[model samples]
Target: MKVANKNIVVTGGGNGVGRELTLKLLSKGAKVIAIDVNQFALQETFRISGKNPNLLIRVLDITDKESVFNFAEEIVSSLGHIDGVINNAGIIQPFIDLKDLKFEQIDRIMNVNFFGTLYMTKAFLNHLLTRPEAHIVNVASMGGFFPFPGQNSYGASKAAVKLMTEGLYSELLGTNVHVSIVFPGGIATDIMKNSDITDKAASDSEKNSKLLLSPAAAASKIISGMEKNKYRLFVGKDSKIMNFMYGINAGFATRLIKRVMGSKMSMEA
Candidate 1:
């Protein structure tokens, strides 16, 4: 589907990948509604977009179904119809091994990363169903395809997203809305920060993690995936590795991921 003249909604558009994609969508002549909890980042994004008249930013918390549903209603009211919806808003919990993982952290991850996306998609489903041709893009992760130690909550959350998107695709087959899932690797972004690793040791280790692509680069590929209506989009080498492992078995993949993640940090050093 062409992006030009389309009304697009991007969640988590305050910063990082979401912001980058929104900018690109606008460049493609699409009207965008950016939703994020960080108003400061929203202001920055708006400023960066040069006061474009086709942009709208709202502070939103997706976990609240009512809030998200209401927000979608507002968008449809103002924009006439939504041509694309990107479920990009998500959070990463602290890096904790399954042995020492906190239950609260796990709950938080599921709340935002999985439930949040679900709520947003559900809220907009009726609207999307009405459109002649629409797109639904869910930003999953390489972690979803391949598990890693210290990524219990993060991986699980994205894995849920993967299944949810696939189910949506199956349900909407031959419909106007095309569904796509994205798996991004070590892009230069602040997702590690979202992991809540405030300790100097973990912070330093995360800071040195390999950055294979810029946020803008990943965002470009993601947007391209939407245009082509791809079933899945992989970003960077990590995604390729995960895809190969996924073909084997998720059980064996878990062990392989643990071994790989152990070396990933040291190799980064």
Candidate 2:
């Protein structure tokens, strides 16, 4: 649905694509409720937005189910209703093999990327059903469908999101709430820094790559897809290409990715 005059909620609105989404939505005359865990980053996003009256920044941990439900209630009470929600907050693990990765790391990734999206969707779903027109956009990753050696856990989490979103679409068919799943590939953002992980090789490669999509550009594509009520949206060219490649031959795509990113991955015995 068109976002103009709609009350939309964007998680991870502190920075990266989320921040850009918040700014662009405001520019489009949408009333945005931007949610993030980082208060400072949310403040910065608001500052960059020039304190738009249509923008509301909230600090909430989406991983906490109770907090998510409470936040939903508060928004409904204040704004009356919500038209859309973008589950965009997620983090990546270190560039290491799953065998070497700790249980804590795996849990953290799943909690934020999968369960967080689940909580947000569940929290606002009933309210969305009440609206005349509503939308739900869940941001998965290129690694969700394809594989990247070191990021197995992260990919798994996103894959869950991908399937969950698709399932929601099937269930919500004939309903006013439109469900869209997004697969984004290699966006130029501070994801590494924000995730508190350090990978010099990955960082250097991203810096040298000209094909990576900017946060602003990715946000534009997401909003456009939402406006069109698209079922699946691929943000970057890389994501689209990989989708095609995987569709043609999953084995070939897997091997190709392993061949390119294998050596860069850090493994431990």
Candidate 3:
């Protein structure tokens, strides 16, 4: 897809992947509408982006369906057309087991990740379908394929996205609308810091974060895949490695991962 002049919306366009993506799109000359729940973060992104002519920010809560629909209406009223949507808004809960997980937390995760994706997709369908070739890219995670301990809720939400996006792709097979899913292994961002629900202790010796890929690196990979209209793309070498390992022996590998990560968590605790 030609990068310049295209209309694009990127959710969670604040201080991490979203921020970098919005910046890149603007640099490429795309008209961008950046959406985020935190007005402060959105403002920070704008400040960093430095008054681009092709950018707008919407401070929004993705879980609010009414707000999303209204926001879509507003965008259509102004832009007249939307060429693509990056369903990138998502939340990760504190590392905890299901039994220890609060009902509120689970609801928050589901509402923001799964239902939010649905709401955005639904809200923008008319606009996207109107275009001859439109794109909807949903960011699932490697955890979607293999459940990660202490992140069961997050994993479940992303797994649903994986299936939902695939279903979307198949459903729109004959239509001009194109849907793609992304499964990033790990990308270094303040995601964990942004997601920390409450005060927690840390181990003295820091272990390397699994999120090894930088946001810029991830953005490049994403844009590359979108250009080819690939159905799915993994952002990191580790993502591909995980895919292979999981595909080869899911049961065994899953257990092995759990053991390893569990050991780390235990040590940290």
lDDT of 1 at 94: 62
Candidate 1 local distance difference test against the native = 0.85
Q: lDDT of candidate 2?
A: 0.94
235-256, model 1: which lDDT tens digit per residue?
A: 8887887788778787787777
* TM-score of every candidate: 0.90, 0.95, 0.94
lDDT of each: 0.85, 0.94, 0.86
Candidate 2: residue pairs that collide: none
lDDT of 2 at 231: 99
Candidate 2, 152-236: lDDT as tens digits: 9999999999999999999999999999999999888888888879543246567457889878999999999999999999989
What's the TM for model 2?
0.95
* Candidate 2 local lDDT, residue 227: 97
